[model samples]
Target: MAKSTLTPELAARFASIALGHVRREYPNKPDHTLAGPQDAQTPSQLHPVFYGSYDWHSCVHSYWMLARLLRLFPDLPVAADIRALFDEQFVAEKIAVECAYLAAPTARGFKRPYGWGWLLKLAEELALHDDRRWSERLRPLAEIFAQRFRDFLPLATYPVRVGTHFNTAFGLRMAMDYAVVTDDRDLAALLGETGRRWYGADADCPAWGEPSGDDFQSSALIEAECMRRLLPAEEFLPWFDRFLPRIAQREPATLFRPATVTDRSDGKIAHLDGLNLSRAWCWRSIASALPECDARRAIAEETADRHLAAGMPRIAGDYMGEHWLASFAVLALEA
Candidate 1:
């Protein structure tokens, strides 16, 4: 029998772990790139809406995870806690503060595409509910990032095909979600055009080089995820075939194996766990996009299981990993 994935019990567990960190503001690690001494501020002081969960993007995606859990399992024990957090923070005034920070001269590219993408993803999750109130409340902030996407993608000539935060494919994949529910044809068109430009010609990927010590994503897999979204089913299949042509032979052995985290106490190094989870999610997506008769489909599904098995065990061992692993676990389990 197949190992169970995405059970309601597991979702609730993941939700509880995420809630613990989303509002824990201490021992904060802000990614503020200060322009001068005058720009100094606490994480919470700088980002009123998103200053917890170790870093800005992690905080943003933790909210995304909770919103996703509540949407999938409304009876979750932490449902009210999730809603209350939203009520307290996702407000006009707080969002205004966030936007103001973005507008600062020192903040020109603050968070750039990665944090920006997760913010849009959180908005996308809120948009999925029957209640449009959260979506309405988040629209102004979402629009800000949406415009950033519009302005940035055109100038970004090459894709950042890394396994780290700056990976171009991961950002676009998240942004595409926001584009769909919001019915932003302009954003969708821009995404389609840019995705094709950056990745459409990708073929015979040599997945041998993977999982740099601090990587939290699989560059190969996330690129696959992005291409699957941007192209039609018929087109995606042929592209996927050439891109991962040796899946049947497992030629890219690195893609089949999960990364090892040497130290969870070291924050950057702990990203290996997230890399596994991200790969699992990507593998599941790749599997779903392939035809049933395709041998790669089974390979994708099995590799997904292996990656999930490796990562799920380490989700809560240390603060370094726990601060954000649940969100990636949710991403994988949901996929």
Candidate 2:
């Protein structure tokens, strides 16, 4: 099958998927911490602006997708609906409540690096639309998350190399986009240094633990993707050659194949679908940074197409995957 690329039609479809649930607060799986009897608040009450799409982080990235689609396809039929949703949710008062929740002692680790990263990514997308005021309203909340990264990275002696939300590489990967777009030299420098500290010496990654049962990411690929985004091509290309030295032959065969999703209805199992999409995104991105005529570029791009073919069709099958899969799909298709 040919590789799927983002088209106006697909963007509209993706936009509709997000718009349908960005406000559908049901079937929620909140990552809340109740400090006391009075702290038992509903998802919407706790996060006025980000209380939909199953969880805070999913909602955050859904918004990011909508914003990006709006920018990419401004004449899309759903563009007005996207604008309306942004007008309703991106208000200063609602964002203040989100900030207040973060300030709570019981909420120190709420969403941690994953949600934090997505929120910053949303802010970065919004900032690109100079005609809109959403980015300005969301700036305060974005700053808090930025500061969290600033405060946490220094104390993070070791990186979490998991394939899930707590993976420090994924967090830095998403957040670095915001830092660079905003010209935040301090945050950018900190993120670059931290990435080197965590992954600089990595060579010949065995990828022995990929597709862990509940994983939505390929830990090895994402770490490489993170480094690609952080380092200059001159430096990153050498590291990439060292890290995945057998990519030309696809030696770590697991990285080249798409994961199987046995049951889309099972949320944990459904993560395998996301794993495929994210891997495609990583592969496409990694390939982009390689020299165009390099053999590994063709190999990586072919692998990415295979992964996308596996995961793209399953994005809307079940609510288990629906609430967030579209975002990963967008990442893969757009990449």
Candidate 3:
């Protein structure tokens, strides 16, 4: 099936697009939970290093997107610029400031699992660089999130199966990547256990109701993706068959098609664009885990392309969407 490609040019375009926002503190759209007097300060004052790209979570992931692109295409035209930005932002003092914000009583559960996961994912990408310096500097924050996962997963009685920021599957999947790269045995084991506990028995998921106006992730697909990571193919295949049964028939219908965004200006509605891109990665990931001869493989790839087509073009026009959409677009195309 045909698909959108993440070529060198596109990587450069995406990197450039993302660089514009990761540090653009103004016109911010922070999701802060201010409680005391000090909490009323601006986002940058609180999150010193990550107060841009509309909100903390978006800024975290956008940094991940840039780190990933540079690693993939080290010779990108904007390579020097990328390195410069990292040098400027990944300082020990800056990271400490970002860490301090988490200490605020009002910021206790600041970004929770969503932003928590992205920060770890960013650290994982930095690990791939030949230099271990950035990864080490990033570890303090990554460790915090890693510990958060270890502490929270078991207490999270029901998995958040939403297609929004708080989605547990998305958090687990990304955090799992960090654990694997850093060899965090405790974090890795906890993730696996919690994932299975929450999703091991799930099956026949009805995914017809999806792409809610503010959805940027697919609850059904992401849950399946998490299961894929934790289980061997032998176990995962049967589980997947039961979870998304009748894929060959496209029974859920919504799972096979791209969602339409009625308005890009509305930041909430623009999440549909992110939904398409994120769904594409989830489809690609799901397809990779399926048996080679499985009919779902072809459908997965085809629909991934359809979703990519639906979101890739609109990733940068509106600042509302532009703030974070490119990160998801990169994931879909790279997947």
Best by lDDT: 2
Estimate the TM-score of every prediction.
0.97, 0.99, 0.97
RMSD of each: 1.2, 0.8, 1.2
lDDT score at residue 275, model 3, on the 0-100 scale:
90
lDDT (tens digit, per residue) of candidate 2 on 1-335: 57789999999999999999999999899998888988898999999999999988999999999999999999999999999999999999999999999998888888878999999999999999966599999999999999999999999999999999999899999999999999999999999999999999999999999879999999999999999999999999999999999998897999998998888899999999999999999999999999888999989999999999988898896999999999999999988
**Global lDDT of each candidate:** 0.87, 0.93, 0.86
Comparing candidate 1 with candidate 2, which one achieves the higher lDDT?
A: 2
lDDT of 2: 0.93
| Structure candidate 3, residue pairs in collision | none
Residue 320, candidate 3: alpha-carbon lDDT: 91
**Tens digit of per-residue lDDT, candidate 1, span 1-335:** 28547888888898888888888898887777787886788888888888889888889998898889889989988899888888898888888889888887767787777888899999999998887788888888899999999999999999998788888998898899899988998998999899889988889999767868799898999999998987889888888888888989986889899898888899888989899999999999889898899887898899998999999999997999998999888878778
Q: Report the number of the highest-TM-score candidate.
A: 2
Better of 2 and 3 by TM-score: 2
Cα lDDT of model 3 by residue, 1-335, tens digit: 56677899989998998889988997887777767675788877878779889888999999998999989999998888989888888889989988777776776677777999899999999999997787888889888888777777777899887889888888888998899998888888888888889999998998866867789888898898888887778988888988998889976888888888998999888899899999999899888887789888988988899888888889888999999988888888877
Q: Model 1 TM-score?
A: 0.97
